[model samples]
Target: MRPLTPGDVRIAACREGDLVALDRHLPSPSHPRRYTRQLAGLGTLLVAWDGGQPVGHCEVRWDGCAAAEVRGVVGDCPEVNGLFVWPESLRRHGIGTALITTAEDLVRDRSGPRIGLGVKDGNTRAAALYVRLGYRPAVPRYLDRWSYVDQDGRMHDNADPCAFLVKELG
Candidate 1:
């Protein structure tokens, strides 16, 4: 597991190329532009590489507020967002945990006491992964209430609801 800087060779700053990689791995291109813009404004975007190929990526942001805010939901804490590991790379090693740990450390360096993220309801695997990493549910589970249509002509509503999970940085 190697750590990559923003413009490193294997993990160049997430430009159009990395966006292609991300689209291929994610369930849909629901918010790639939004995520790209966020990555541009946020501190750093970390991508993991296997043999010099981009394999996984995560984004970390510092809330200008003394508190954290995700999708307009604000809290008195720092947060991490847009963490995704390529499906093809799951379980081959500890890449996902490494990414999360890196995000935690970055937030901690900023004097953040806690970090938080929201996981879609039904993504049990991701939720479980967070739990195993010491994150616990911190906000009431609620329906997302937003909707989008995917490339497959399928509609998904944030209505599926999500649990906001948080981890205290020590």
Candidate 2:
């Protein structure tokens, strides 16, 4: 998609009704209802919308990683996890940046010392984005604590090598 200007998209905290409104706009090959339900109970889920279509979405985990095993991976750092930009065509247009910015704002307002996030070891593109935004790797070089539910309602488990990154956000 063409680069989107600030006027072309708006980022806001997702409301309860957005779960249904965004049901059809989720990334392909994924079940919208499952994603909607997951975000519904997770920490704040933010959405980037172009009028009525959701182009991107992300979640902030106040307590820790959703997985119980990695709860203190960041040691009290609020995590900006589950970042996704749908329709592939809508990426590289600053939507992800805007979403992260909003997340930082949310964290800062809560007086968090810093924000944390994890990137798959193989996802160099996403790692670069986090670096550009000033996040640096934390200890625990590689973690297998990443897990999530898939579209089919199946609990999938993966020990994908992941690195935890953190950025101080006074």
Candidate 3:
């Protein structure tokens, strides 16, 4: 039940554990290996842990140009590559907001003015959370089946259309 900073002892020592937690939460193509690469490249990751167990996590990536696309929305922006809270801890309180606040802080320091992310269209709860945190729908409608291939040669068609969401950092 505490905020875990990047350099803090708990975070430093639990990178792998955090990765496992992330793997469990996000879907394929958004798996741990991909997440690790993205996080390393993006330069910012925040996690909330309870007694050394990662309970929530969020990450943002600099998509090279001022304009970036996330979940199908394109614009001059940084992307919220991932945000997940463990299902068991969903009702515990404050963890999701805390993780998001940390991400905003990181983006602010980088002088980023806007951030974006994609959520499955049917996932109203997650969308609501993002909206509550200031994200607004940037896309007119959800985009269809984005394809992703995993290391195992399994192809995944993200059947659930996704809606793009954006938040102004400034």
Off by over 4 Å in 2: 1-3, 27-42, 66-73, 144-154
What candidate 1 gets wrong by more than 4 Å, as runs, is: 1-40, 64-76, 145-157
Report the C-alpha displacement of residue 67, candidate 3, in angstroms.
Answer: 12
- Superposed by TM-score, candidate 1 places the C-alpha of residue 114 at a distance from the truth, in angstroms, of 0.7
Error of 2 at 146 (Å): 5.3
> Which tens-of-lDDT digit does each residue in 1-170 have in candidate 2?
45667568899877767776667787433334334544665477778998888988887876656544345556657788778987787788789999999999988997577888888878999999999999998744565554457778888666766788889886
Question: Which should have the higher lDDT, number 2 or number 3?
Answer: 2
Clashing pairs in 3: 66-76, 67-75, 67-76
Q: Evaluate model 2: give its TM-score.
A: 0.81
Candidate 3 is scored at a TM of 0.68
Q: What are the models' TM-scores?
A: 0.65, 0.81, 0.68
> Worst lDDT window (10 residues) for model 3?
5-14
Q: What lDDT does model 3 reach?
A: 0.61
Deviation in angstroms for 130 in model 1? 1.2
